[model samples]
Target chain A: MDLVLIQLLNGVQYGLLIFLAASGLTLVFGIMGVINLSHGSFYMLGAYGALTLTQFTGDIFLSLALGVPLAFVFGFIIEWLFIRHLYDRDHLQQVLLTFALILIFNEAQKILWGSYPHSVPVPGYLQGGIKISQFLSYPYYRVAVAAFCVALALAMMFVIQKTRIGRIIRAGESNREMVEALGIDSRLLFRFVFASGAALAATAGIVAAPLESVYPGIGEPVLIISFVVVVIGGIGSIKGAFVGAILIGVADALGKVYFPAFSSSVVYALMAAVLIARPGGLFGRAA
Target chain B: MHNKSRITRRDALKMAGVGAAAAAFPFARPAISQGAPLRVGLLLPYSGTFAALGDGITNAMDLYVKQQGGKLAGRTIEWVKVDDESAPPKATELTSKLVQGEKVDVLIGTVHSGVAMAMAKIAREAGIPTLIPNAGANVLTRAQCAKNIFRTSFGNSQPGVATGIAMIKAGIKTAVTYSWGYAAGEESVAGFKESFVAGGGKIIKELTLPFPNVEFQAGLAEIASLKPQAVYSFYAGGGALKYMQDYAAAGLKSSIQLWGPGFLTDGVEKAAGAAGEGVKTALHYVESLDNAENKKFRADYNAAFKRFPDVYAVQGWDTTQLLDVGLKAVGGDIKKQDDLYKAMRAAKFNSPRGPFRLSAAQNPIHNFYLRELKGGENVYLGVAAADVSDPTTGCNLA
Candidate 1:
């Protein structure tokens, strides 16, 4: 039973990490209404940027401070030059354009950093073990990461629930035509939201870089999992992204902890079960 | 008396001429060097998920081809390569193209063990020779063992056995392994488990990480709960990098030592970094090996590539070297499969990975030494040898 408790905690921790990754991906799709397949590419860039910045500054917090803004700036440039034009295009076209961006990002990353995984070390302050109990102990970094995720989740709720920007985002999600009919430009709002979403992805990437590897094709797996999150969460729902991310995370983590031989397959099983029980996700708006 | 002396000298010269003629005649050019640039089909992973890893191996082989003057023994070594994508069906298709379309003389390469097994069948069916660089799972030599197939790689079990024996000798008591679900990983784990158990060590936990989706957090957590003395794994390439970093973050670095099948060479150092510090694994070649032949190969290879040769590059270099030695043994008389096979089995070639002979199963019997990454290069500690037999590998390799 203690082992089960430990695994549940492990699952929650894993879920938190997945939520950090999937939240930004959900916003890019939900607010923008254009499928950004390369959202994970932004995450990868953020990780790479964090790696470089941390190495240069020798401070992980300062590195993140530097990377988050750079990610927004990169998103701005990419949006203005490449992604903005594809807004009115079909879903297939959007997928193709974003897929093309994936190749560009992968190659550009290789050309800039060479074909190797850059090791991102965890900050020295967060580098020791913490005692969970007399018999069990866990890494403080992981627990701190979980706390960080909760803080981010609270911050996200504040930004989207109580702010003027949140009102505009809600207007945009409900009815795009109606949002434009209010005499306020949705395009400018979308561009900013999209850019902010990119920053969120970068934030996750920076936080996870020291934990996971930063390498070529690194963005692709995350991108696919993000898609799974969006579908399961019901597109255009931030609350659903959180719930879906946690569900997937817990299912995946527990599956591996208890039944490692069937780890990958477990996520799909949960998705299947969710589809049967709740077709529109836990907090999704009804059509 | 002078005329008699001159006649004897002429007779001796005549004999010398006859001997020189016989010696040079086989290696001597016949208006054209190399026999029709014997087509060597490369069944490789050029266009797939494994493309990135395959790219390095393919680049090394092509580098060897160019360095050998675009020819092997005066014959152009034309590469008729197909991107297997590490898929079995695709590999079989490409082999058909190589056999029928390209009419290759010998087959080489194949990163995936399954792909290698398929190509082995092609070689057997077509009466051609196949030289594998690193697909060392035992199955290639066991159930599906063919006549003309030869491997230059240390068998799959060699690395695991080497690591297991070294850890056992090092006085480790408890160990846990994070192995992927594949023949390569499974075979290595099997070898490690056997040796580790026999050497009076206990396996506290054995975790298998599935392929395609490798989120290692849960596995790391489970293993941490077990509280083993040491941890070993067979995760390679990018996956290995993630495992190492996460392993470090999971707070196992200071408490539990990391064990691997020696994927800690220059190839993986980029992915692993400081977390892989003090990591011990087994391999036939370490960058720190000091020998006249290895020194020459290193200098020459570095001068050409501007970097130290990794295991993949070494494998490519050794493959060509073995081919050259076999050709020389048969005096480049590679008109028939039997001749090439016989010469290869002799194992008279000097390899970069020290001296070892080939088993009748066509796998190399070699020393698998424990090496560590120190100061950005592989440091060979001492002699670590494991005498592996030609046990029947149950690969269903095809």
Candidate 2:
């Protein structure tokens, strides 16, 4: 029973992490009608950024602080320099271009950091396990990750429903053509949205590095799962990404504990089930 | 600028061979056993995920050539190095290239068991003597064992069997085998089970985690549910660090002893810091082995690489020495496949891990020792084998 409880927490923790990564991808793909395969590469950059900063400063919080803004800036620069031009292009082109970006990101990282997986430490205070019960304990870092993602989700809900920028984002998503006719710089807005999406991905990478360990192709698997989350949630819907992440996470957690052999298939099975039921995903809309 | 040593046709040919080997396939030739420079191909992944160890293996082979009066027998041993990319398809294509195009007399070096198995088939079909340094899939020397293939390094069974014996000797009853659910993992666990049952030890659970794709914490929780006295896992690469960290974090470190194959001290494990410390492992070789060969090897490696050689590097070096003992004895006449095979089978070399015997199954019956990490160094605790050998190889030599 204690073991189950611990695995349940593990499910929630991993689910929250998935949400943080998938939300941005879903938004960009759903809103702009662009499939950004490079989204995971941005996350990888963010992790390397944080790792580099921590090496220099010896402070996790400070590195994350630097990492977050830098991720945003880097994403903005990439969107402006490469992705902004790709907005109106076909999704196939977007995929090809972004796939190229994955290679670029991997090579760039190798040039900057070499090919070794850099280990990131959880802050000393948060490194130990916290006993939740007599036989059950959880790592503080995992709990922190859950709490952090939960707080991020709340902040996202607020930004989408209660803010003018959120209104602009929503308006732009609903009708890109109409929003452009209203004198809003859709070009600049696209750059902003792309950058923001990139920032979110990087944030996930930075926070998860302590558990995942930052490596060259670390973003590839997460990118695949985020796509699964996006498809299951209704592309472009924050709420959709959230639901998809939790569903996938729960399935994955249970699969590992029970059907150890077919555990990997469980995540895909959940995706297939969601596709069959919802057709367009929970929060997704038809073209 | 046109000095013969500096710029020559030989250099261009060498460079072309390397460049072609790197890219541009379709260079595979037939089994041409015409008296060439006794070309010995050391096919390793030099520019892939396994490059860390591959580079070391290449260097070790080079060192062996240097020791052999810079030549093999009367001929200057022409080494044809090719990258396998750790992919079986690439390995298959490349193995054909090495055998057919490069006309390599002997084939050596592989880090991935999958690639090794693929290469083993190709080499055996071409009637080439293939000696593996450190790819530990038992099937390579078992069900699919090729007649032409020989292994010098320890197989997957060593770790599992040694750890199993160690567990029984230490009075552990109910143990759990946690391993990556693949050939390598299965071999280790099977070996462990065989040895464990022989010693009257009982295993309650066998948990197989996916390789390079496991959530260590979730695995840990599942393990805790088993409530076994000890947990033995055979995991490698980045997974080792995460397993050790999560095992400790999940509080399993206090209750169940964590043990596995010797990948706990890989180069990637070094970055794991204190997380990997105290994780018990079964190793074929350790830096702590008290021997003159190892002492010289350690000093030379440290001086060259400016770091202590890990399992990958050490295995590569030892493989070169292992090959040298056999290749030189037959005067590198690998064109006589039977002659070379006979010579190597009768071959025994001094190594840091002590002497090993090549079983009839083309696999080595080797020593296994229980080891642990002490400040980033593998410290051997006890010898699991006193002239240890394997009796379970299923290789069909007929």
TM-score of chain A of each: 0.94, 0.96
lDDT of each: 0.73, 0.76
| Ten contiguous residues minimizing lDDT sum, candidate 2 chain B | B1-10
Write one digit per residue (lDDT tens) for candidate 2, span B1-398.
Answer: 12222222443576687567647654453345333356778888654345556755665666666666766655566678786766776888889999999877778868777788888888878878777877887777777777677787667776778878877887888888888887778888998898888998888888887755757667777777777878888877556666777777777777778777787556665677777777777777777888888788778766644555666666666666655666666666555656667766776667656665677776766677878777866678988655555554566762
* Regions of candidate 2 where Cα sits further than 4 Å from its true position: A111-118, A133-136, B1-59, B62-106, B325-334
C-alpha lDDT (0 to 100) for residue B176 of candidate 1: 88
Model 1 per-residue lDDT tens digits across residues B1-398: 23323433553475476467647876553444346556677777643234445545555666666777877666666566666766776777788888888777778867777777777777778867788887876777776677677887766777888888888888899998888877778888888898899999999878888753457767776776788888878876667777776776666777778887776334767457677777777778787777776787778766654555677667777777778767666666577556777777876555667776787777777767778766556678876665555465553322
In model 1 chain A, the worst 10-residue window by lDDT is A128-137
The alpha-carbon deviation from the true structure for residue A193 of candidate 1, after best TM-score superposition, in angstroms, is: 3.3
TM-score for all models, in order of appearance: 0.85, 0.88
lDDT of 2 by residue, A53-165 (tens): 87887867788788888888888898878887887688788989899999878756655665445578778888778875443358888888899999999999899889988
**Please, what are the lDDT tens digits per residue for candidate 1 over residues A1-287?**
26667677877877777777788877778778788988988888888888788879887678888888888888888888877888888889989998999877875665555444567777788776665533245767778778988899888888889999888888888788898998879888878878887888888888877777666566666777787777788777777778888888888777876677778888788777777777865665553
List, for all models, the DockQ compared with the true complex.
0.19, 0.33
